[model samples]
Target: MKQMTLKTTSDLSLAIAKDRFSRGTLWRFPARVPLLLLVTGLCLQMPAVWAQQQETPGKAAIPQESPFGTYGSFEKLLQAAQGGDADAQVKVSLCYGKGIGVTQDYEKAFTWAMKAAEQENAGGASIVAGCYLQGKGVEQNIPQAIEWVTKAANRGDVMAQYNLAATYYEGLYGIPKDEEKAFFWAEKAANQGDREAQCLLGVCYLTGKGVTKNLEKSAYWSQKASDQGAPAAQRNMGIFYAMGLGGLKKDVNKALELWKKAAEAGDSEAQYALGSCYAGDVEYYDPDKIYQNMPEAKKWLQKAADQGHERAKETLERLFHIKASS
Candidate 1:
């Protein structure tokens, strides 16, 4: 078995010790690729230390005394980052901020994110803005946050674009609520594969917030967002499918799929839909295939109820009583 070691004094070594997240199973979308955001710490710091230690004293010189002696995944990738991988720099910074797989340390997060931002990494700039906004490791400053977010948004960081849109829409931190600016930033983010932005843009289209009202455009954007697994989009699509809007031709199967995706992602509306789907005995609907077992139906309904969905709350109470009697 090959072993790797890190020294306690090395900045790279400390970063490796802090990044431990591996995304277990909660992530499942193209947008979720940035969960790799948490992966940066582990990716940036392990290899160089190993190489240096290996070169010095073979197996004997490897420091087992350091706290990171046990990490085994992606050590080589981390080493590459330690050697100055820009992508790795951003990832490590994210890990520091969220404490995703490692100990939460704002100072390290700020430092690493700043390093990547200086290199013009949009993702890094977004995270750094978040830190500034929240006063995490740096002093709170909305102007600074906006500057960083704008930089990243301009560079096509979808998350940054979304934040920028929110800032402009709310007029937070002296920014005026310019609908055009909101639309501009949100559209930019949506185009860059941000599911939330897609859904928000769809909503904007539906309400004619920034752009003129266009139901077809709304449906188009909603579908785009839904396909990428946006919970809000799933809910919107489910509603559309249920209502047969925008020339959709109303497919129950498609509606069910969107609801399922939304429910799995913990959307209360989707959970309620799942309950409703099970309880309704429509002539063409396959209750067995859609809701299948009553127990799962109850589980989802209860989850929605807990989230304060009124319809779900009422449904769950009735279902619970029926189950008790049965």
Candidate 2:
């Protein structure tokens, strides 16, 4: 088996960040939406009476209900929030926070979210933590964010758990680094089927960080997250299959299958692998199985190139020059 090495964009970014933060240990945070849903329900339970109050600058006084019922408008949602509707409050806060269908205003975002969080809304608490953590309409306060995230995590908010695990993993803030604690929380969230946690856990197993180096465990967790449609996990699984590592038998067919799935999902690594497969004369690359004549290699390579997969771009350039000269 030939081992082909490819340069990845993330590798370059990591290298740059490492060089910059060398003297000072910068924690890598992996918080995603999966870790924030722990308080989702609480954020959805606020009273709906406050829905009528409009807090934006120079916005029309919108009606509570759009001309069509169930038409899905932020104005109605805000009205519902003002009416003390918890779910409406969460929706409105998100709208304000993200500037969706309204002007972006973190203060307004915090104001609405705080209303729900004050009521012990789990989702609201998580959102509030996010606001403080990112300084969205509030000061960037890691301690305060951690405080709220901890509250949400203790309540089994999956998103909060993920965020907390990420925090522990990165060891940012005044918090000391603790990989063991990170792994514990990640495992808890992964067991609950959190894709990000599952992916991170897979990486941990792969790198022997916070756990014994176990390729089998790495592939297992990666597969779990991959099945849930995580692009990175899908690409990693394809790599595992290709290398026959992590208890996976060398199955070029399986590798190709996974590579195709992930490539189509916009993963540059998988795209490059798919291009290689289609351009080859392997048994599985028979005309019937692979549309080799359809310029697949170019297509996949171009996709990977667009993603800054250096090797793919070089390959494409070489192929183009060869074709042009001929």
RMSD of 1: 15.8
Candidate 1 ranges with C-alpha deviation above 4 Å: 1-105, 169-178, 281-299, 316-326
* Model 2, span 1-326: residue lDDT tens: 23344332122111111222233422211122222222222222111111111111112223444321252676776787888976567556766765667887778888887787777776677777767766777877878877887776776666566666666766656678678877887898788777767877887777766888787888899898888776667777776765567888866667778888878876677788778666662323435445554288778877878877776776666664422111
Q: Best candidate per lDDT, number?
A: 2
Best by TM-score: 2
Residues 1-326 of candidate 1 have per-residue lDDT tens digits of: 11111111111111110111111111110121234434323322211111111111111222233222233333543564477766666656655655644677888777877887888877677666766766777887777877887888787766567666655655655778777888888799778766656776776677676898776787898898778666767877776675566568767778778878878977776777766666552233454445555677687777877766666666656655532211
Question: CA lDDT, every prediction?
Answer: 0.58, 0.61
TM-score of candidate 2 to 2 decimals:
0.65
After the best TM-score superposition of candidate 2, give how far the Cα of residue 236 lies from its true spot, in angstroms.
1.1
**What's the lDDT of the predicted structure labeled candidate 2?**
0.61
Worst 10 residues of 2 by lDDT: 47-56
